[model samples]
Target: MLNEMRALTVSELTHQIKQQLEGTFFHCVVEGEISNIAFPASGHVYFSLKDSGASLRVVAWRTQAGKFRELLRQGEKVEIRGSITLYAPRGEYQLVANQVSPQGVGALYAAFEKLKNQLRLEGLFEPFHKKTIPAHPRKIGIITSQSAAALQDVLKTLRLHRPDIETVLYPSLVQGADAPASIVNALNIANTRAEVDVILLVRGGGSIEDLWAFNDEAVARAIFASTIPIISGIGHETDTTIADYVADLRAETPTMAAKLSAVSQDELRQALDLFEMRMTGVVREKVTKYRRYLHRLSLRLQAQQPAHFLKESRQTLGYLSEKLEHLMLKRLSCYQQQLTNYEARLNPRHLVGQQAMLLQQLSGLESRMADAVKRKQTQEEQRFEALVGRLNNLNPLAVLSRGYSAVKSGDQLISSVALVNQGDELTIVLSDGEVIARAETIIPHENSPHNKGI
Candidate 1:
């Protein structure tokens, strides 16, 4: 006996088959090298996963693609977690992948480590080779994609910390095969200008392949060769590259880099206020001491009046004259007695001996007195020369001869930006000449591009 046959449309058959495959293979894993990768405007990623034995069509829709787009590339081995499904229109079977990750020993990753070790042996990663990031900088340079999220992060941070800090952007391709060359060129441009105090090399977080440009040998060597200091903020906190090792400083993210490069103006203003207070206190103390000294000097001068000193001197001279007249009369009587005794016993030999002895004593005393006076004069001369030498050392003009200049506003020295304004006249005193100029700008050290944003 024969049964009645029921014919079905292609649409109906395809739909039924799709349901069966989806139901039976609810979940599966595919490990293979990726090929024929295509990312259309729709945001869905289509690629072929191939092995030595066979190939399978795979699709990662927009949602899953977005999660790991930076991790995908052609020829890389990857493990796809997905469910098998049938495409009714094409009459083909494909895998709809929900997750993707690099398979064992990702080729790009192996190369990265190999190169890293090679460079390490060559001492490229040594700490001594790294330059010091300036504590204060006049300008900042940035190297990144103009439209990259990393650039925006850094700029936003800079605005928050120090808007006055000047920044120069060197745009470049931060991903793809040609990204290495673009980054190298940007580095070169920054070095040529040499205007910025430090350069920030930054990019958003990505997989090994996306961030490979920073791992290039050329880029690493260029960073090493740069005379200006460089800060690397290439990826997420967990992500590190060769550039990070070569840079003067490493920041976990672009925003962190900007914060590291500038200081808060409010904090600096507070510090300046404290310094002014201290200086005022010191000056007041000095003024008080000087006033006291002048008061004491005035009292001393009043007590030493010339008229009082003259009257005292005249009275003392009259008394001394009267006493001298009495002493001279007494001495004359004693001398007459001594002379009569000497004449009774006197001889020529004895008189000659006494005269010679007195002359010898006088000569010795004179020589000793002359020697003491000569020594005192030499000591005073030596002390005067030493004082003159010290005075010269403290002279501002002497300092100018050693390549230092002093800026003065009127007669006052200009030590800080707070003391001057735009268009103010200034005198710059150098060793050999003076320059009359106008203050065109006032740049505070704390507001410089390379200060800690305290």
Candidate 2:
């Protein structure tokens, strides 16, 4: 009976343990001081994360090890986010960390906390100092790195939600020592213009040091001093910064900040309803104010009529075009979101084909809309030119321009040479001037009536 039982080889036992460990500790975050940190010529990192009594082996592949290699000092505290796997050959369980962040990093953290507390004590975070955001802002100014994905995210959200709103970008450095000054300058410029109703200070999520620029004292003060309401969307939802507290509004992410700056379709519809009810009362109460406004508007309107007409017309078309395009893109993004959730389960080929087809459809639609706009503009120009042609045809000066003249004999138009006798007084009207002449001779044809002279 003992012979009937099978014995597990060393390889089999190791594989079974590896499966168990990987299944349970597939992903986790651990914090400890690094020790015996070794970076060999192969570029992989070998280290041990240990506290008082326990030590865990850690391995970082070349791709991720480079980012934190300089900070890999022995006994340095850090937080590692990775999965655990067993190296079957050595039968050792080690952490495979892809992200390593300094934990309560000695100087940077202390400095950050110090500044944050100082700002709070100064009442920079007070709610009373905050400016109210406009309900339906016509213009939104954005401050961030031009290359950041946060800018793209906010722009996409803005386009999707409010295609009619005008956007102005104030690109600046969102990292390093100079970032604070750059951000402050951008804020000052946006406020100086006093053109935009709101400003969004935003950037993507990053490590603490990478995001330290947003936590700067100068940036926080700039946000507090802004005349325009500022919405801070710096980093992920869990990340906290001093600028977020000093700003008028704090968004969980850059996308949410963009959402806050935009007026949704539902809000627009509700606003329209409320506007109608408020208009009558508002007009009655503000008659004098409106009269003065109208006087100023009349003067400006007279000067800007043609330009205003064209600008308004183009804005209407642009808004419509943007709305249509973004709505379609939003739907595609939804499909992409769904695909992302099932990307592992679905065939890659199928996903690629689906994306290609959608892109083709979108391109066709965009091309057609562009062509339509072009054709409409062309048709209007042609119609205007046709009207001008008809007007020219009815103009008497046009015939005169084409080498024609009129002869008047004694205040009566002379139609035939016979009517103009020799030495008759005649007034010849040319395009430029008039000539008064006494016909010296009259040449008449035999077939002409009364032997009319030519």
Candidate 3:
């Protein structure tokens, strides 16, 4: 009795009932007169399917009131085939029509559905089967009627944005009986040649009968099987066909198809700037390493004799300095050339401004580099001067200032009597002057005044 008395919330009961009714009428075919019809901007049709006995809510999604926009009318007798599903939010049951037709005219629509369902079951329309559309295609292959206005639209768009990219046209019938075969052949030829990076399957807007070729099984299969990614631009934004689903990408119009194939000039400029920044970063890293090496060498100088080490290190530092200067100049020149080349390719709109900015930046960089080199040179010079001052203090000339002298015979220093002969001419170097003298009599060490008792 307690089990029976247990209460269910309104939401829980509604959900249970929704599941039961939805499952019970999963697939249904209803023949009724249309009433309470509302066509919303989202392209989903809302209407009630009514007969004398009952009226059921029905929606034909994305049909846009069929190809000619006159398929459904108030009180018009029609058949809708779909699955029953709960709207959930309103807790109302409705029919989600996958196929809708006005009595006898359904034969063609039925065939479209048949092919769509079969291909869908085979997973051709799955995201996994779709190829990635190239972000920037170097060459785009166009497949359309030679006389098509859509072809002109595509060409004009590509020319406006990316005139550098080449295009190859494979003229094929876009309509009528021979179009399917022509399209298939074009696709096959494109695959065989593989000249283009991507293919644009395009046509002008038309009625369902006029656009029937794109729905052909052979065309759909060809599009799905192509090695090159295919972008379908068939009919207007509201129109949907089998090829649109099978394509790697779908554009609403022929112009949009071309626009999608290549990026804009602004994007290219940004890429160039990014490349320049990365290159600048590399140069900065090299400069930092060289500076650190110089710093390490400077620290090592204090512990070792500067005379010999400075001579050898000075050569190395000079070479490295010249090498660094040459490398920087070359890199800057390369950047200038690259900017000039890219500028030529880009649209002239605000191009002068960009070039000016880059030039300013380049000038700033050169100035900074010069400053860095100048500072480094000044630091090294200061360090060298201080080292020379220390060396001078240790020099014998400092001792000669306090009543001492150095005597030399020719280029040799006469340090002892054994180094000089009698009457040898000598040049004595004092602190501030030199004197010419002669060793008139060479005395033994024992006979010198310091060696004998005073």
Best by the TM-score measure: 1
Q: How many clashes (backbone N, Cα, C below 3 Å) per candidate? A: 2, 1, 0
Error of 2 at 193 (Å): 1.2
Q: Write the per-residue lDDT of candidate 3 for residues 217-300, one digit (tens) a residue.
A: 999999999999999999988778999999999999888888877786668889989999999999999999999999999878
Candidate 1 segments whose C-alpha is farther than 4 A from its true place? 1-105, 262-267, 270-285, 288-292, 307-454
* TM-score, candidate number 3: 0.46
lDDT of each: 0.88, 0.90, 0.87
The TM-scores of all predictions, comma-separated, are 0.49, 0.43, 0.46
Q: Candidate 1 on 132-232: residue-level lDDT in tens?
A: 88766789899999999999899888887778889999999999889989998999999999889999899999866778899999999889889988999
Which scores greater on TM-score, model 1 or model 3?
1
What lDDT is reached at residue 152 by model 2?
A: 98
Q: At residue 205, what lDDT does model 1 achieve?
A: 92
Model 2, residue 67: distance off in Å is 17
lDDT-sorted candidate list, best first: 2, 1, 3
Clashes of 1: 2
What is the C-alpha lDDT profile of model 2 across 138-162, one tens digit per residue? 8999999999999999999998888
